[model samples]
Target: MKKNQEIKKSLAEILELPKDIVLDIPKITMVGNLQLYIENHKGILEYSNTRIRINTKSGVLRVIGKNLLLKSIVVEEMVIVGEIHQVEFTD
Candidate 1:
């Protein structure tokens, strides 16, 4: 698996493609501490006012914050809005 990932990374670089898309990795975008955009997520594992767990290809993404809300959700992406204190990935 590790070898495959390294090959993918090399191909992405050589092809000048976005690594996240080529390697099937999650793309996380943050706007200060107020909003977050997660692309290429598998699903929402957990959700609450102060915590959220999202499943992705690489791992479980944990978001800890205040007044966290799922602003929007779609097949491939999700928008989160709140006081995002911490974002972590757990394998």
Candidate 2:
């Protein structure tokens, strides 16, 4: 796995491509502290008022906030709206 990641990183640098796009990793976008957009997600692992966990190609994405709501969800992307406090990825 480490070798694969190293290869992908090198490829990304050589090709001048975004690593997330090249490696099929999740792209997370945050809007202020109220909303978040996650692209290239695999699925939702968990959801709740204060927390949400999403599965992606890279790892498990965890969203921590208050009044968390899954505004939209599809196969390729998801939009979360709330008072977002922290976002992290875990293996």
Candidate 3:
């Protein structure tokens, strides 16, 4: 019934996520006081100089740093501006 429908919807969402990141437990990626990339993010909750907050259905997160910039964001993709140091992440 209703519960089954909700479960189905949730499963569909899970299926849509990148397989490698499906269980990766979303994290906040910060680049040297210049930018932040919240992996698997649902949405932004709040913001300030020293902190940026986010709220996901699974959890709430807080990022602490300085000169934080929102360089770029895309569907399943993001880029940050820093010393361009040591690119990491595999698809």
- Which prediction has the highest lDDT against the true structure? 1
Candidate 1 global lDDT: 0.96
Candidate 3 lDDT, 48-83, residue by residue in tens: 555555554346665555554446766553444433
Looking at candidate 3, the ten consecutive residues that score lowest on lDDT are 82-91
**TM-score top scorer:** 1
Model 1 stretches with alpha carbons more than 4 Å out: none
TM-score of the candidate numbered 1? 0.93
What RMSD does each model have against the real structure? 1.0, 1.2, 8.2
Per-model TM-score on C-alpha atoms: 0.93, 0.91, 0.46
Candidates' C-alpha lDDT = 0.96, 0.92, 0.53
lDDT of 1 by residue, 1-91 (tens): 9999999999999999998899998999999999999999999999999999999998999999999999999998999999999999998
Ranking by TM-score: 1, 2, 3
Error of 3 at 60 (Å): 1.0
Candidate 2's residue-wise lDDT over 31-79, tens digit each?
9999999999999989999989999988899999999998988888899
**Model 3: number of clashes?**
0
Which residue pairs clash within candidate 3? none
